[model samples]
Target: MAASDNTPATSGLHQQAVDLLHALTGRADAHFHPGQFEAIEALVENSRRALVVQRTGWGKSAVYFIASLLLRARGRGPTLIVSPLLALMRDQVAAASRAGVCAASISSANATEWSQVLGQLDRDEVDVLLISPERLNNARFREEQLPQLVNRMGLLVVDEAHCISDWGHDFRPDYRRIKDLIRQLPPTVPVLATTATANQRVVHDVQEQLGVGLVESGREPVMTLRGPLARASLRLGVLRLPSNTVRLAWLLEHLGSLEGSGIVYALTISAAEDTAHALREAGYNVEAYTGRTDPADRERLESALKDNQVKALVATSALGMGFDKPDLGFVVHMGAPSSPVAYYQQVGRAGRATERADVLLLPGMEDREIWEYFATASMPTEAKARAVLRELGEAQAPLSVGALEARVDIKRSPLNMLLRVLAVEGAVEQVQGGWQVTGAAWHYDAPRYQRIHQARINEQNAMLDYENKSTCRMQMLVEQLDDPQAAPCGRCDNCAGAWYPTHVSQQAAENATATLKRVGVEIDPRAQWPVGLQRLGVPLKGTIAPGERAAAGRAVARLTDLGWGNRLREIFHTDAQGAPVDQPVDQELGRACVEVLAQWAHDGWSGAGRPAGIVSMPSVHRPQLVQSLAMGLAGAGRLPYLGELALAPGHPGGAGGNGAYQLASVWQKFQITPQLQTALDNMNGAPVLLVDDLVDSRWSLTVAARELRLAGAAAVLPFVLASRG
Candidate 1:
């Protein structure tokens, strides 16, 4: 493409920046926002590092895009963007394309395209390359591709830059690696970091990290542009529904009238899915977007919402951050987020390119439960971190995650989180096969994590305050971010009155109860054994042989489910006094379990005859819970109750871990009672019902079923009260 006739002849950098900004925005008359021009000038003319903490829709992407164009024109290399999510990268790539910039991404969603993207980069045909933080730890990428790219990178842009700070509401251990990365970049290269949800503390930490390895040059001071975060387009409100029942009913009654296509946020994936299902049944064209959503399906759903073909998206935090739709109409929270900053960020997604978008929060008593669970999930434990280091140090070669799990007792998710934390701290380095110790002395930084934990407590309290505050809701939120510009907005319920209705009809309430009362969740069977099982002395490999695997099992609901999760948590949660005592199964949930089996039977489940007998899995903590469930099911279905499966004297409990470790822990560990074997032998070929409290890794069920099948049971149908994801 040729330059415009209006392109000024041999101009200064400022004129060039202005021209590029117009091209970037596709508006010849487009000019920069107050701080946008300054940021561009800092990056392009002065080659200064900068951090921009402005609201969403403030053209943070434009700052880097326009700056990249100007620098590349001067023969600088491609800008490397460390993006956090696929949705963000997709939007940025599209946004850069509209600006006539060539951009490509390498992420899990496009693993097949990495070589092509690398080829493009090799040819210098890419203007920007977007990669996840996890990519930085890829040994091959770091040792081979990264050094070359880092040497020539014209500018480094950290989108969602607040994540670089541990103090940020959504702290990611992977993002901590950017500090090491920044320290390696040449001082002459400019860096720009951008986020929509940082306060003073987060801004200061990010700014300090952005200044890493930049001590040599006489670059300008790191510019910090923080504008007032109050978005006047949002009309905020809080609806304190008495229960999840009333909340779902209110949505059933009022969702259609809310506004144009938008997002309805739920705190958990289960809630998001259940809410979407209920809303769809009520004739709303809604869909659920969660971490579990298929990548292709997420793309499809996002497109549907963008095209207004869907009413609203029911989504978890998975849908948050840099999901761009200029005309996204509103955002509704079914339950409050853990932090006001997080809440602000989700609500910020709405009203970016619209006027007067509705933002409402319906707080729940269960919100605190969810908060407590997730707040401590990523905090590093000294014992776990030390165990990983020891494992890696003692290994002759790098151990893959599966191999590492077999050696260590930690579950996969927490283990992976610890690995990332160790990687960030320079204690462990991911290698070709798996991971290795770096020999770097690492401390657990208890104070920092403790501060983060307490900060979460403070944030939770602030969220509650926002819900019940007599002052302006919007002001309270902005203030929670420590924004100096916070002020009362007359649009909130407290400021004026609620712009939303508070009433749900009895019919809608009944519909919600019907939806919530519905039970049964699919237990995804383990199709393949964990890798390196043979190394762990278990012969299993690829697929679990068809006959030995349990049939698609049945559970009333996941512990995360909105319908039964509440009661299950009550049964599972350790109270202030101590651990949950073993209690009898609730009659309603027991009936729900019966309902699940009944439906399974209707769906042609009983091949060898409706379960010949019921057997309970042995439980050290909740033996009574298991017994009560087995007895109730046996009574309701008129089946004989076989006593609990026997365990060796010192047999360990069914704690969750990866497949190989769990299987190794329980392999041949259960002893079939002589009475049970006699009972099974007498049946001559009959299916048996196996019951348990919960299923996580499912190795116990698998091993137990293998034992039962070996002991003459024709088929084993595994049932559980709850499944943990």
Candidate 2:
């Protein structure tokens, strides 16, 4: 079957696809967008590999859905769609149902549906199957079900296909497995990869990956259908506010006036939560959506925004990609995204079906710092990769992530990502018990990673350029995405004069200031010691005895909090020598700490009496800051100031690493000095408030509290200026 076949059968198939399109949209006048029908024809008639690089609202779903039905009608097997987000899968499933395509999904979220979905697949009852990329590697699915599915799969659709490329803004390691999946699929099956956020680099990378095995089979190169990326409906702008409080005030003053319900994007979870809280306090109907948001709640929130029941959902990147709401009125970024392409993807959510919608970027001073942190965290280093490989190679049995976390210094999230990367490279395998070495040779690929790192830096700079540039915001984004037809969108704030109000009422500013100033974030104490600590030469395992455990603690603020976070970041800011500045507590922060203590005491300290005295942890870096905070609190509360704990000589001082390593670094590192012992004795076994500058792993707090409890204090109440999550 060739694209130029044009037989009566091909003509009938095209007519059927057109009819299905009308059924899908419930509009008799509904017609295909520019590349939609061609993409469908390529897949259905020619069974060709196609990459559709269209804008967000460009009906990429229609092309695949129509092709799937056309292929199934020809006695082909079920269509297999590897979708990224669960929300996207839900939307696709519902849309399939409306279009008379029986669709089913199997994901971690729906274990109960697995058997039923499998049954439907075996019976040829399911017309389309949606799954996450990670699902392809599930042991049972990969070993048992995937082979059969691959043999029978009529059409393979990779939604959000940008994720398959390392150059993609939101690349996931599991998405690389799709390349292997493409190779495994029958040569006759048509493959469709779709994304709205791929630049030329990403597009070429995706095209190459999609062509895997096809060219060897003498199949033609993938047909790429790219369209102009500009969206006429979006009215873009950048509003530079001085601080987080002013931005919140701006939203308070102007959010209600926005045309309809939409998203308010934040860079981090804490920022999203804080912004949503402020908006809700201002009497706006909004909720915070983040990775931390519950799955059920995410579905509910998506529905709420879709139905226009809420003014907005203040969300992190979790709400992005494949979230469909055609008439979303606005998208307001609390801070600019690290990439112009990513910003375009998120803001593209607005005005899909409507005549007009607003998109605004409220660039923040902290955005770069946040971007840098994530950029580094996401990329695997050569040392860490080799460390993981060495650990797996040495293990006799497969090592679970918990075991690997203790053996390797990487945390669980990054460790999982690293394992996936290794597995993809044929250096590791995830078996039933855990992960094991695959005995395959692996190289560092340093040059490639360096190139990617530089690319990310360039993207960050482009985003900053987007914020500062006086030219068309939309044009800058399209150009960043390599849209050759990128022309000035006449609707943006620059082309047209500012359409949004910048005024913040004095009352609103005061209210926002109050919200940001409010403090007191609970620091939940670590209950159990990390597994495999014994292997780390630390004889700690299982739950810490309740008697030895520090009571749930308090931090004046999280290091990421909007209000106190800014101040705490400055206090903990590193000096030119790359060491924490050993400064005393400032009056403003001191008062805030006192207010936190007052509230904590009022809220009841785990049903204990007030703290009898204060003791400071031995901080190798910020000792002065810790001591000042402890002494200030002791003096304010009229309690005795117990002497500080002594740090053992030759103790490891740096922070970071996983739980086991962090605990091992500080274990037995703090000793109760004789003077501190005497001070604790003088307190008559009362609870002691143990103060520290910051809590990262909580190991320092836990280890210090254990020493205090063992050294005569009745209870240890850990207090910190900030908690780094």
Candidate 3:
């Protein structure tokens, strides 16, 4: 059906949709946005698949909710919406209730309500049901509930449809399953996919996926209704401060002046938490939202921001996508995201229902380094994929992730991601017990992965260009998103003048510096040995012996810390020759280490008293740095300096492996040198501080501490310059 097909029947449907929209928004005069009514008409009247690419506040929800109510009044079943975020689902469910559409959602956060939701669905009392894409692979749901839901689905809605394409910035492997679900849907079911972000490539890919099995069935191709992506309400600008402290100081001086409560996005969780702490210390009502935040706390934080109970929520990407706040007044970025498209999507969250909102980016020098780390992390390696496949093929039964971790070198998070990719490629299947090979031959898509990796690099460079671009910032973003309506908005700092304050008070700068300089990150000791270590020839299982455990330790700062992180990153940074640089601890860092030690002493150790001596871990990469830090601390404290631990002969010194393999590689790798033993004997059972340049897995510290404890030391307290959290 053509968008221009507005017959008398379509007109009547439009009138009803407008009425439903009014009810949804609590406005008697509410009307559909430019493309909303057409998309709704295509879905409701023609039962055609449609993809609506509109701006954030374009009433995509209104289109779907109104269509669902219309379908239900015509005796169609409940709409099945595969929403990406819990925040999105909550908002949709509440909105559905307001529109008098009975909606229920089944998500991991609401497992207790599953039975109730299922009952409602069975009783045909639910007009719309929302769920996460991951739920589609749940064994019980896939086998029992999903089939029934598919059979009776009045309409299929894929929220955040860009995730269906790998070209999308925020693609999820589980979203690939949506294509199969769409293929399985009945021919009569109208499908609607909605998103506010997607480049031309991503849009085409999504179109192909959404059109699965429909073309062969003689149904119309998916109709795409894309509107202009530019937002007239956002005044965008880039503010380049010299250091993290100064940038934070700017926020301290100016955050309150923003129109309303908004978000400050950081690239890393540590940055977000650190910024939130600084703001709170300065008496700002703020909270941190990150991937590590508890689900309940996340809900509370979202509500707090929505109700304007808090001034702002300092967050990482965890707060992006589908978080709705119509009157959000400002959006500040502590660091630029890698892609212009992603940046646009996040900033679009602001100025949605307001006349004007400020969007500022404080580009960090460390942003590229952080971007490279994530880019590499998200890409799957052929060697690791093959290793996973070989292990599963040889296994007698399905293997749980833990068991697979024991056999493969990949870490847990990356391993889970690789498995999802494999499952999507049809090489593996997740079952009740665990994951199993499906006997399907799989080829590593080297070219495709390479293209994606290069695409990320290009995007990162494009982001840099965005920061430096003197033309319209919004136009650059829309063009990057392939929005044809891209043009100078005449409102950004480039088009107009900088609308934000750039001044930072001396007092605020001092406070920010103090916040950054504050040190001591606690390192939790490994309480229990990693499971299945016995399979790797290590006889460790269950709880580690208390006598062998190191006391909870401390690091001067995390490698990702917004303050000292840059300084420490320089210390551990690799040289041009691609080898780790070894250097002595600078006076500044040494003083910081002393500060950490002083705080630890004041706080009191958990299982030991003040250190009587310092012993350094043998570092293959940074021996000089490790020795310098330990000896310097020993001298400053006027304590005996115990010699460093010796590496066992033929010990393999390397990194990058899972817990079991990491433990195996370092098992018995550290030996108590004769010099260290002599120093320990003189300490008379006093606690010794074990120093290392960096701590990644903590397995090395655990093993070295065990050696020290067995060698007559009463306790070992681990300390490091930085932690790789």
Candidate 4:
């Protein structure tokens, strides 16, 4: 537009913005927070870059929506917001609609509506458009749509802007693309970045990236407005529960007595589901919200909680960040999060628009273990990154993740993250089919990754200190976030005294114990070989012939389950040398094994009649553990124990990787032993029970069962102690 158009607004323009705010909020009493007006003014009037770091309920959305309306009214183009999550976009869309803003999202979830949304954008019908940072990596979106949008865009907003910084608690490699997006935008276009949880380091990092580097983009210096990170309405407390059983019992005892609709955060998806199940059985209206939840069901669940139709949603961190429910009465953490910053963000969800709300942390003993798993999962390994690079470098055509997995040895989540990082570094490009090497020069920044990793460790230790604090928890949290105005709230448990009941009913504890003691989750068989395995030289593709596939398997428990997960995790814990050294299955676990078999039979997932024989998959790390479990089951069930499947010289086990690579790693490693073949031949086609210690990828079970069936076993019913997701 013109220089005059980007100048400060007149009184009439400011009044029109105020009127638009009222129309958007539908409340005559609606007023801006301390810096909200300044943020809006900077974006709408001066076309300036601004960073607003306020608390969760500080009306950051209002600032953007109002600014978008004012800009659009002045004949500027629509606002384009780069949001971090789908939940945030959904809430923002609804909030925008409330203000008469014709907002729409072009996201992975709304592919069918993209053309319509694009048409709306072209016709100047859309006032706001929300999209994920990952969308910028889309070939078509980056090449076509984004360039046009950037040319006419009135304002740029980056929600959860802290994610752009590697120093941030939730540093997403995808958000790094925002820097490129910001660089591509018109120099005169207004820009706003907002986040609830960013320390000084993160703030400066984000600001530098936002200013298009420390050199300032030849534009006005970015305006930073960071407020105190404190929530007066939330009463924080850390309750050190003795065990998971005690924690569940405490919830059973105290949840109903707590205030309005709220959320219960669990560290893992299974924990959330199990806690939700336990709470439901205790007659509390609750539901589970996790990455595993279906998109439509998640919407329903979120709506149900928001409308107060459900008491709470037992959720992982997936339910956090842009979910808006004003009077949410309480926020409880089933286990302490890895960082205080993350905890603050979660507890901030409660008491957003209330005088007082309860926020408790029912800290568990298993918290550290769970923390370690996630911490390791997020960091990219040099070996794995180079493996991905080497594989991509050799591929003749663009390959999807599944195809990449066949060639590379990395898990799906980490692999996806690495691809994004590589894309940002110009080492790779995401295309229509999948990803391709861009043939761009790339260097491994070991020092940078190490620095970030060390920062995370420091954060983790700080969180542990927060859990152990005798002083004000709220004060500690704020200081950790680097809030200059940090102060004790006099509302937390440490500030006042224990306001929560410490007593748990004996019956509640018994019921919790009973529920937790229950085990045996069905493990679904892999019906088809992973795609592109043939390219990986495994020579396998398409459906596993029905006859060759293992029968639907059974496990004592998932390694992530709320029940046997704790023990199984400890048993399978990796050593200081960074390799797993397994422990033998004891008699106590033997009893649990019996229970699993009984439950399996009771459920009839396993065919009628006990297994005629037993075969165990040889373990690279835990032979004794696998042997003992198989032998215990064999003796208990009174079935003949066949020999274990022998490794055909070079099977390295599944190790850790995606399905196709895992399959390739184990495909040629196992063979039916002569002794087992003779045992199977003698059984005259009677079903045999195959046992293993861990079921990570299920490739071992599939391959082992295939060998057994080839040796004439009628059916191979695979069993494992733990199923790792």
Given candidate 1, what's the lDDT at residue 266?
94
Instruction: Score every model by TM-score.
Output: 0.94, 0.97, 0.97, 0.95
Q: Candidate 3, residues 628-685: lDDT per residue as tens digits?
A: 9989999999988888899999976666399989988899899998888888888889
Give every collision pair in model 2.
none
Comparing 1 with 2 on TM-score, the higher-scoring candidate is 2
In candidate 1, which residue pairs clash? Answer: none
Instruction: Report the alpha-carbon TM-score of model 1 versus the true structure.
Output: 0.94
True-structure RMSD for candidate 4: 3.7
Model 4 residue runs over 4 Å out of place are: 1-10, 213-218, 573-584, 607-610, 650-656
Q: How accurate is candidate 2 locally (lDDT)?
A: 0.89
Worst 10 residues of 1 by lDDT: 1-10
Tell me the whole-model lDDT of each prediction, alpha carbons only: 0.85, 0.89, 0.91, 0.86
Q: Please give the range of 10 consecutive residues that has the lowest summed lDDT in model 4.
A: 1-10
- What lDDT tens digits, residue by residue, belong to model 4 across residues 1-725? 00122334457766776677678778665555667777887887788889999998888888899899888888999999999889899999988898899999999999999999999988999999999988988999989899899899999999999889888878888888888888887776888999999989999998888888436556678899988789888888888888888889999889998899999999998899889989899899999999999999988999999999999999999998788898999999998899889888888888888899999988888888888888888888888888888988888888888778777878788889899999988899998888999888888899998998888788889988888878799999989889999987898888899989999999999989887888877878789888877776787788898778778888888877877888888888788998878667888889999988878878774663457989998777788899988899999989889888888875455464778777777777888777877888899988889999888778888888888878887888988888876
Q: Which stretches in model 3 have alpha-carbon errors above 4 Å?
A: 1-10
Q: lDDT winner among the candidates?
A: 3
Evaluate model 4: give its lDDT: 0.86
